[model samples]
Every structure is written in structure tokens, then in C-alpha cells.
Target: MVGVLVATHGRLAEEFLNSAAMLVGEKEQMSSVCVLPGQSPEEFLELAEKKVEELDTGDGVLALVDIAGGTPNNTMFRLSMTHKIRILTGVNLPMVMYCVMERSDEMTMEELIEALLENGRNEISEFGKR
Candidate 1:
């Protein structure tokens, strides 16, 4: 029942949310923040913090970051320490898709995190070459 935030470098974060919405229509529990290149760390932090706060409405917030040790991930991590939010790095289409699907009245934070990580790890492979 927690809120979801997609924060990533460049336009990836916004694109993730947009693509998911396009694939399955509009959603209520999701939002995004895009950290463009050449932006100062302070700027990224402000934007990310604002996005997290906007989504944080008592159910808690979960931030899906694109890369570990990067600006977005690091900023999310810092916010997690102070806010009631969880962070799942290495985000992908599968992760976002699965999270939205499994999120419901009965799903726990642990369960959603597991689904995101597991689905994100699923290989998109071709069985036969064209």
C-alpha cells in the first residue's frame, strides 16, 4: 500500500513512468523524478526530495533507482535514512511493471521489493535468432 517513486539519471525516470502508464493506462501510486546530466548534486537532491515528499503520504514511499552509487541512488539512500521510505536500485521495465501489478491491499513492502528485484533480474532473451 506504499507509494512508488521512479528516480533516475537523465530522462529515464520520467520515461519509465510514462512507458508503464502507456502499457497499462494511468496509475495512482506511482510518480517520477528525472535527474538530468550536468545538473548539480544539490539540484538533484532538491528535486528528488520534493518528489519523495510529494508521494510520501503516510503509506510510505519506495524509490526505484536506476544505478547503484550513482547520483539518484545516493540521494534516495540519504532520504531513506530520514524518511519512512525504502529504496530499490537497478530499476528496469520489468521491475516497474511487476511492482505495479503486485501492489495491492494485501502486499507488504518486503513482497513488493522481492517482486521488483526478481522481475528486474529476469533475462530478456531470444530463443532463436531471426
Candidate 2:
């Protein structure tokens, strides 16, 4: 299974993981890192690297962040250069759920990343519109 790492500002990453667990039950090979206020980039990088190493099992990892160009996203981008991982921004419940449900040994990292992008995009809709 491809490991999943969620890094976001404040408690978003933790809460998002909790919510995903509530919907799909507990997930294996998944972890989260919360970037708190006043935290330095070096601190965040250290935590992220640790999580990636812990989750990675030679199948690579998927790093999800809340927003593109944000600290979390930027840190993940840098980390990706040194690790076998892919970074996905704009993370939401649907994206997390899709990762949890679709991740497996049979799925290649490229395939999983493509499916996640497609699923995350297709899930977005404007409510009360027809």
C-alpha cells in the first residue's frame, strides 16, 4: 500500500485524518503532521521527513497538503526531492477517502496519484445549482 502523509496548518491535518477515519474506519500506513503557529520551516521539515520514513515501505508515499504554495505544501515539495513521494495540494475529505480506499500493493504510485487527482476534482461541486 502507498503510504499517505497529510501536512497542514494548525489542526487541519489531524482533524482531516480523524474525519476520514470516522467515515472509512481506521487506515493503515497513514499519518498526519500539524504545522502550528510560530513553528519554523526546519521544524516542519524534520517532522515531515520522519513521518515519510515511518510510512514508506518501499512503495513510496503520498504527501497531501491543504493549499498550494503554503508552508506545508512548500515543505512537502522540498521533501519530495529527497524521497520517493508525490505531493498533492488542495486536500479534502474526498481526496483522503479516495486514498484510503484505493491504496494497495497492486496500484503503482503513478496510477494512485492520477486516480487521486481525478477523484478529488470530480468530487467538487457547487451545491444548490442545476
Candidate 3:
């Protein structure tokens, strides 16, 4: 299974992991990193890299961030140069759930990336009448 890493500002990543666990039971090879107030980008990057290293077990890691241009995303981008991981921004509950429930050890990196994007997109919709 592809390892999942949720990185975001404040406690958002932690909260998302908690919620995902509640919805789909506990997940293995999954972790979260939060960039707290006054925390430097380098600090966040170091923490995130540790988590990624811990979670990764041959199968690559998947990182989800709250914002595209925020500290977490930027740090992830920098780390991507040296790690075998993919970062997805604008992470939501559905996206987390999809990744947790759908990913498997047999799936390739490209397939996992496509599935994450497809499921995340499909989860969004206009509930009210058009």
C-alpha cells in the first residue's frame, strides 16, 4: 500500500487524519505533520521528511497538503526532489478517505496518482439544484 502523509498548517493535518480514521478505521503506513505558529519552513521540512521516511516501505509516499502555495506544499515540493513521493494540494475529507480505502500494494505510482485525482474530483459536486 502507498504510504500517506498529510502535511498542513496548524492542526489541520492531524484533524484530517483523525477524521479519516473514524470513517474508515485505523490505517497503517499513514501519518500527519502540522506546521505550527512560529515554526520555520526548514523545521517543517525536516519533520515532514522524517514522517515520509518512516511511512515509506518501498511503496512510495503520498503527501496531501491544505494549500497549494503554503508552507507545507512548498516544503513538500522541495523534498520531492530527493524522495519518491507525490504531493496533492487542496486536500479534503473525500480525498483522504479515497486514498486510504483505495490504495493497495499492487497499484503502481501512476495508477495511485490518477485514482487520487479522479476520486477527489468526483467527490465535489453541487448538491443543490442548478
Candidate 2: tens digits of C-alpha lDDT, residues 1-130: 7899999999999988899889996778999998998999999999999999999999988999999999989998898899988899999888888777777789888998899899999989998798
TM-score of each: 0.88, 0.95, 0.94
**Candidate 1: worst-modelled 10 consecutive residues by lDDT:** 120-129
Please tell me which model should have the higher lDDT, number 2 or number 3: 2
Instruction: Give the per-residue lDDT digits (tens) of candidate 3, residues 31-100.
Output: 9999999998888888999998998898889889999999999998898899988989989888888767
- lDDT for each residue of candidate 1 in 15-61, tens digit (9 for 90 to 100): 88778777866567788888886899899888888887887767788
Q: How well does candidate 3 score on lDDT at residue 29?
A: 87
The most accurate candidate by lDDT is 2
State each model's CA lDDT, in order: 0.81, 0.89, 0.88
Give all candidate RMSDs, comma-separated.
2.0, 1.0, 1.2
Deviation in angstroms for 90 in model 1? 1.4
* Pairs of residues clashing in candidate 2: none
Task: Identify the runs in model 2 with alpha carbons over 4 angstroms from their true place.
Answer: none
Q: Which of 1 and 2 is ahead in lDDT?
A: 2
